[model samples]
Structure formats: structure tokens, C-alpha cells
Target: MKDMIPVDRKMSTMQDSKISARGVQVYYGETHAIKDVSVEIADNTVTAFIGPSGCGKSTFLRCINRMNDTIDTARVMGDILIDGEDIYDPRVDPVQLRAKVGMVFQKPNPFPKSIYDNVAYGPKIHGLARNKADLDEIVEKSLRKAALWEEAKDRLDKPGTGLSGGQQQRLCIARAIATAPEVLLMDEPCSALDPIATAQVEELIDELRQSYSVVIVTHSMQQAARVSQKTAFFHLGNLVEYDDTDKIFTNPQDPRTESYISGRIG
Candidate 1:
């Protein structure tokens, strides 16, 4: 069973939300990919989206960082606000928005570059550093945050892709953190990793929430229950339920949520 937080603490978290969505709908060509879905994600917290395949959990996850904009036929409507600023506003630059909201994909797709360069790439393009020393410090700090500095320190000049699956994932995580993002979006970040690697990444996720709002899409109910404070269940493009992870797991309000959590559906 999952542990529950105090109701007062939950209320405080609600007031401290960092990302707010309202009436959000998404489409790819004529097919609707996401129904009207809305939720508030609190800063310094871990939120997980869980559901069966093709349920639009991943689709909704991408909306937070606007990754769907890269798809030619994709269309997103409704407001997605980060810190009260609407991201879809004409004034917002998608490129800059991406930097503030970094993403880590399921596969450990590190740049074909060296480990150090992989972490340094973001700070370089974003000009987060002024000189070589600044870039070096950023790289070290990011790698440390990802819990990979000790293992990867000596091999900084080696190719990132040459690392083990878990190491590569951690490197990707370090790369994301190097940008100093306010929110971190992870899409099945541990799906490609082994048990040990998944555990390592899960720990990293917990640590990351201490700094940034983390939103993750995962197929594993155990993973979601283990790492997330808040959980949302999606089914057939609809947000069926969202609540404290404990409530969603132990005593869901919606029948669909209860069904999914009890292994009756999904």
C-alpha cells in the first residue's frame, strides 16, 4: 500500500502548482489524439501519467513541453501555462520554451558526442556559460546531479553512446539538467533499462523533484506508485482520474481508476 500525505500538505501543494492546463485538446490530422484534459502540476513534486497503450498518456506528456510542435500534422488547442504564462501565446518562443522545459526520452539517446560534450551541449547553445570554466563547472554539476559524475568522470572524453544503457540514460538526464530547466518531462525513461538501471533512474527522479517539477509517462503501475506523489490515469484520450498517488492506488474515486489500479483494466 502507498503512504498518504496530510490533507493540509496536499492543499499547500495545490496552491503551489507550477504548471496549469485547461481544456487542452490535441489532434493529428483529423484524428483527435487527446480529449479535453486539464490538471495542475505542483513544483518540486513528481507527477506520473499512467495508462494502457494508445491512451494518449504520452500525447498529453508531450504537450507540457510542446514536443508535438515538431510533428507536421499535430494541432494543440487550449491553454498550457507554466508559472502563469501561457506557452502557446504568440509572444513565446518555442525554442526558449523548450530550454526552460527539458525532456528525457525513453531511449538513452545521447548525442553521438563525448560524454562531457553531451552534457556541455545544452549550456553551450543556450549560452548559459560565459567561458570554458563555466561550461566545465556546469557539466560537472549536472553529471553529479544525475549521479553519474563518479562513474563517468574519468571517461568524459569517451563517446556517450559507448556507455551502458543505464549510464547513457543518466547522461541524457545530465544533459537535460544542464539547461537549468524549471520542469523536467520524462517519457518512459526507464523502459529501455534493466532492473538495476531502472532503480538508479528512479532514485534520480526522486532527487530531481527537489529542484524541478517532474512529469513522467510510464506504463508500469509499480513505477508510478513508487516514484510519483500525484498520479493521473488516462484512457482512450480522456483523463479518467487524477489525485494523490495513495488515493489513486488505494481508494480511487473513479471506477476506471479503480479498475486500472486493481488490474481489472489496462
Candidate 2:
């Protein structure tokens, strides 16, 4: 369905698509954390995933870059394709896959290195730069994209951990984009920021959609409405509703969706 050609064992060719999840399920040891979920994420758009705590929104987000694979007992069953390639394929390297599918977490985490080095880390490892000049350009471009270049340019050698929380988070975003990813997965990026910082990050998120497919998991409904063009509502591990931001917020077809939007359920 939807420009996809069926294949065997959780494999599919989703050409011209940014991200596609089919019959996705997740398990932690013996507990089933996510039920069968399916959705398609478009390129150059921001898709927000909203739900109550532990509703599997973040869990599903982690599946995109295989972050859950770090857990000893976390098992994922499904096909997650980006640009027609199956990320779970044996031939695919998770490190490289992560480069293509960058992520920013709930809390800002910058390496304990200079601001310049923090932004240049990914490019250095991925060989995106030819030399010091190239790395410097990449760092400057990434920081500008994250909207932190003007503030941090004078302090390039300063430790990234020395910046304010909001600046640190923006630094992390710069690092993520330095590798030139096609999809960006953010897990509640504004949860830890002040209102002003959140507003700035929100603005940056909107701008980022011009270059990459951004998928954000946010607890804030207003943030989702402001940043995303499409929205998906999850409940107790199931994807209850997915539609245009206006439709999902204004006139949801599903009762559960309406309840959540109306403050009846979460």
C-alpha cells in the first residue's frame, strides 16, 4: 500500500518515502510494550507523536534509529524503511543508519568537548570533512542551522557543557545534523527547556523541516500543533489516530482521540 511493494519478513520497498513503519511491535523481556503500529512519515515535514507517558511514543521513536537495541531485552518486530531501504537488514550498519537518522533526546547531552569539537564530532567520525577547514565549515553550517552559531561563534573552543541548557540542546542538534541525516527523531526536546528557550527551539524545528524529515515525540499538545504538519496520537501502545494537524486536533474521528484532545483521557 501507498507506494510500497510487499516483501518477506518485515521487509518492504517504500520508494520516494521518508519513513514507513509496518506492523511494528516492541517487547521488553516478556512484556509487550508496543502493539502492531503502522504509519508513513513524509520527507521535509515535521511529524509529531503525542501520547501520555509510557504510551510507546518514545519507544517507537527509538525504533527508527534502533536506539532500543541498546537494551539487552528490547526486541523489535517490524519493518522500518527509509527511502526504500530496510534499516534492520543484516547488511545495514546501525552506526551508519543512525547517522542517516539523527536524534535529539529529552535532555540535552553534549559531549564534554569544545563547542566546535562537539559539532564536528559526527563529521569527523563519518569522514564528512577533508581537513580542519572542512570540519570548521561543517561545524559553522550545522550550528547556524540549529540557530546557535551567532551565540557560540566567539567561544568555539569553550566546552559545550559550559553553555546554558538551551544552548547545549541546540549544540546537540547541530551535532546530529552535521552528518547530513535525512530523518531527525526528537524525543520531547522541549520538556527540559524554559519557555523562551522552548520557543526558540520550536522556531528552529520549523526551519529544520526544510532539510530533513523531523519526527518529534512531545507531551505538549500545543508544541505538537505548532511544529508538526501531521500528528499521530498513541494510547496504551496502539496508534489511535493519525491525520493532518488540524483534523486530528479539531475534529478527530476516533473517540479516544477526541477524549484526549478534550482532556477527558490521556
Candidate 3:
């Protein structure tokens, strides 16, 4: 496995990180998914992970929130620190950790419950609000942040599954943000949407970066270029290069990154 890159060496000194990973690796049974990958995620910035299928971009993203822990056969090694605290420590609760680091999947998996219920689920579980009024406020704030409040406000009682694809995805985003997480993880969030829907989600992602650190895994280089400040390119379970999005797209130091960007190979 390749040596992990030091976070301070890779990121700008001016940037303050929300999460710092060091010597991270992940495996599913005997299959190695991520190989000694380390990088810093700056607060209030969007970091994009781009690579071909099976390159472990999504795998690394899932590692941040301990999502891989749900898989019985999965094993993770090394330290992942959130606010300089290691998340993998036995004392750390995965459930609580997930509340601080929310995730949205590639597909919009809205609950069968009402639109209001969908957004309220996270806060309800995390005990973020006590009274009904407080819960309502939390839900509304979350929906507004996700840019879905105006569209869904009147239909709060309606089933989340009844909404349009893009609306449903936004509802999911609202749900993730309801807990007021410090970081948000998105795994190919716009993959299933049409061009217009994709654009809307992309815009929402940009708006979200104002308050939370975001790490997105996308197969589309164009989308990565458009939404992310920092970009990491993975190839064959290796993080081949990580740098500013402009540099990664325009003048990457690694031949592998250059070849993938130029369409020679992925």
C-alpha cells in the first residue's frame, strides 16, 4: 500500500479542517477497498472524490461517517479524526458520530412517512429537540437550508415518496441536515436525476458549503469540477493525487490523473 499523505502537507495552511484522516485503510473480508488514504476536509468547503468504478472513492467517503461499520465483513484500520478526535475509538459511539456527520446516498431513499416526518427523523432520534415547537423549528430550519422548504412547506403531511425525484432527494438532504451535522457526505447524489434536477442539486450543494464541510463522491469529472474546491483522484484503491480542483483538472502532477482527465483512461 502507498504511504498516506500528511494532511498539513497537502492542504493550504490557511484552511481549517473539520476532519483529518491519517493512514486510513478499509477492507471487505479479504478484498482491500481503500489503501492507506489520508486527507483533510476543510470546514465550509466542498471536497470531491473522483475516479472510475471500483477505485474506492465512495469507499473512502463512507469511511468518514463510519458507514462501512454496517457491513459485517468490513474492516477499517487507522485513525479518522473529527475536530482532532479519533472517531474509531471504542469509546466513540457510531450512532452519535453519524449524527455529527450525516450522509446522503446515490439514490434518494426517502421514508414512506410524511415529508415532515422525513426531515424530522434525525432530530427525533438524536434527541436534538425536546418540545413539539422546538422539533418543528428544527425541521423547518433544516428544510430551508436544504432549499426544499418553499416547495414542500404546504405538503408537510404528504408522503415523502409521493414527491418528484429531485424533491425527494432534497427532502433526504433536509433530513440529513436536520441534526445540524458539522460534515455532510454525499455519494453520487445527482447520478439518478435529469439535467435540470442535477443542476438544482448541484446548486444546493454549493449553498450547503456555507455552513458545513462536504465530501462528495462522483463519477462525473465535470460535476466534481463544478462543485468542489478540493478534488482527490483515486485509481485502483490508491489515492493517486489530491489537490485544488483547478489543478487536478488543468494541471495534475500525476500521469494517472492527467490521463483520466484527458479521456485516455480512467
Query: For this target, which candidate reaches the highest lDDT against the unseen true structure?
Result: 1
Q: Which lDDT tens digits does candidate 1 get at residues 11-73?
A: 224446799999999999998989999999998889999998999999988988889999999
Better of 1 and 2 by TM-score: 1
lDDT of 1 at 65: 85
Using TM-score, give the best candidate's number: 1
Model 3 agreement with the true structure over 95-206: per-residue lDDT tens digits: 9999999999999999999999999999888888989999999999999988899999999999999999998888999999999999999999999898898989999998
Order the candidate numbers by lDDT, best to worst. 1, 2, 3
Off by over 4 Å in 3: 1-14
Q: Which stretches of candidate 2 lie over 4 Å from their true place?
A: 1-16
How much lDDT does each candidate structure score? Answer: 0.92, 0.89, 0.89
Could you arrange the candidates by TM-score from highest to lowest? 1, 3, 2
The TM-scores of all predictions, comma-separated, are: 0.95, 0.93, 0.94
Lowest summed lDDT across 10 adjacent residues in model 3 is found at 1-10
